[model samples]
Target: MSLTTEQITWLTKEQISWFTKKQTQTFTKEQISVFTKEQIQALIPQQITYFMETQIPYFNEKQIPWFTTEQIQALTIQQIQTFTKEQIHWLIYLQIQALTPTQISVFTSKQVLAIAEEQIPYFNKKQIKAFTPTQILTFTTKQISAFIEQQIKEFTPTQITYFNEKQIQTFTKTQIQALTKEQIKEFTPTQITYFNEKQIPWFTTEQIQALTIQQIQTFTKEQIHWLIYLQIQALTPTQISVFTSKQVLAIAEEQIPYFNKKQIKAFTPTQILTFTTKQISAFIEQQIKEFTPTQITYFNEKQIQTFTKTQIQALTKEQIKEFTPTQITYFNEKQIPWFTDWQIPYFNEKQIQAFTPTQIESFTEEQIKNSPQLLLRKEEIKSFNSKEINKYNLNNETLSSEIKNNSRKL
Candidate 1:
């Protein structure tokens, strides 16, 4: 016959130790609840395994920590599942470490949340992986940060998705750097937004490339400013296209050339306009050639003036055709001669007419000869001496008549 609750409560600690596993299995929840802490401590691992689910919750915090690691580990899954949040929190360090992956895997979200932050890191990788996303979400920021590198690697992308912004923000820079490319790619755009500026630059080049366009768009100007050289270079054209105008200005001058032609062309006109003169000068000839006419028109006077002869000469006719008259006058005398003979004709009459006298004189005779459609203002023609005008093959009478006729229309 089962012992009554009153009789069970009256048992001595020594008497509790004498009970067989068969006798332990017959104890009711009421009988278990009446046991003194001293009596509960006397139960062996074998007796503990036979405790019914209904009896396990009756163990008070004072009684719970008395469970030896062997007794804790030996508990049936049903008995383990019966642990109250308070009981889970009361478990000692050794008791937590004793849990098998199978036992850890069965923890309800509340049970996972009840784990003491100090004991979180004791879980092995297998135990870490065994947690469902629901359980993963229950981990406090302190508990999330307590994870070692090996434990962090065990988090699958699916499990990582459940981590709220606060949990993601608790990651150390070292932890951020330790993320594999695949793991880095899996962060949701919202999750990635929680990464602090200090952590942003620590991402490896491969990890940067692994970011989606949506993730790239989510970066703040502060985060964009901290991206290292290789990380900036790793951004794909699609990723580059999403950067805000403020973010574009955050790119360092030294990093500007690392952008490939397609990446350079990915900037919107507003973004293009934000490029500093130093950044514009960083563009290689190939990158210069990639700028759309609308993008070319967005360059400020300083930006236009900073272009090297090689970059200026590299601009396609379509790009040249879009230059404003103000932009044309911004080019220094040295830059004038770099324009190819073929490129000269694409300039509108207003553009050709806008060049300063020094700029007109800088043009080579071969350039004048090859560009039959090149338009020169009457004043620009007067800047050349007669011998030079003869050498340039200007038909003064015919040009004078045409100039007079053009002035009449104006």
Candidate 2:
């Protein structure tokens, strides 16, 4: 016997299931539209599967909220594909978990995006792994933003690569922090560009180490600007050694005051030489004080010449004391002029005397005129020519004059 829509809606759950199983495929769209949300929610899993695929899309959006998670879990792929964005958006977290990978695979992009924020993690990474890269790419900015750390790590590199540059830009710092080294290694230059300064510092040390020379070279100056002292401190010597001169110079001058002692110690002198004159000149006095003197031998004369006179004078006596004779030899005559009179007494006879006579000869007339006399003994003074001694502006007569006068007196 045929029942009216009103009567059918009033039927008990058992009767409704029996009637649906027998006639569901034959039901007209108008008849199906009249089924109450309660009747749909009460259907047994087996009976829920009996609805015609064509009719499933007819269910009003409100009907999905009442369907038990178990009923939704029993949906076939064809039935799942029939859901409209409106219906899918209403699925609760429990029902979201109920969507099998087969069902998940059929969701249209809008339907997938409509998945609620709270329900995002229900993809149960296994489901995520099964998603084709194209399907994963459909994730909206908010949808991608909703991913938890573990879920983010499950994204395959190919899936991650499918992210349009704009979608990639939306990753939260927490999600960025979750990135595996292997995953980070696959980040494209375009994707790398979207990272904000605060986001980069969250990288684990291993993640930083895994950055390719290509990727590190791509960092925008602004990204480099926010890498704080501690964040910079986390990098290994090897990791830090990869920065291009431009990249290193892009770093905030103020951020790297410990450069020579800590960050720069890892750099070969050739690498250290890449710093711009301004960058080298920006060294705070504390940085100059703590700088390793042994590293000085690596400086080419040109690099050594960049240190301002003030910086030269700021060098502590102890720091200067570490300068090997080899280190002293690297200084050109022009660089020697930056030292002050106060610094003159600290150079012991060996370090000062290490300069070849030719380098001393290249000294400017002013350098010779003001040069210290006591740093060497009387014999050292005797080695100087009468002209060189005269350049010292000493009170005594010329050495040649002294010799002749003393002979005559004898």
Task: Give per-residue CA lDDT, model 2, range 34-139, as digits (tens).
Answer: 7787777667888878887888987776566778878988888878877877787778777877777777777866677667776787777777776776667877
Q: Which prediction has the highest TM-score against the true structure? A: 2
Worst 10 residues of 1 by lDDT: 372-381
Worst 10 residues of 2 by lDDT: 373-382
- Stretches of model 2 off by over 4 angstroms after superposition: 1-3, 19-22, 116-131, 148-159, 178-186, 201-214, 258-262, 284-295, 308-410
Error of 2 at 104 (Å): 2.0
User: Each model's C-alpha lDDT?
Assistant: 0.78, 0.70
Clashing pairs in 2: none
| TM-score for each model | 0.65, 0.73
Q: Over all chains combined, what TM-score does candidate 2 have?
A: 0.73
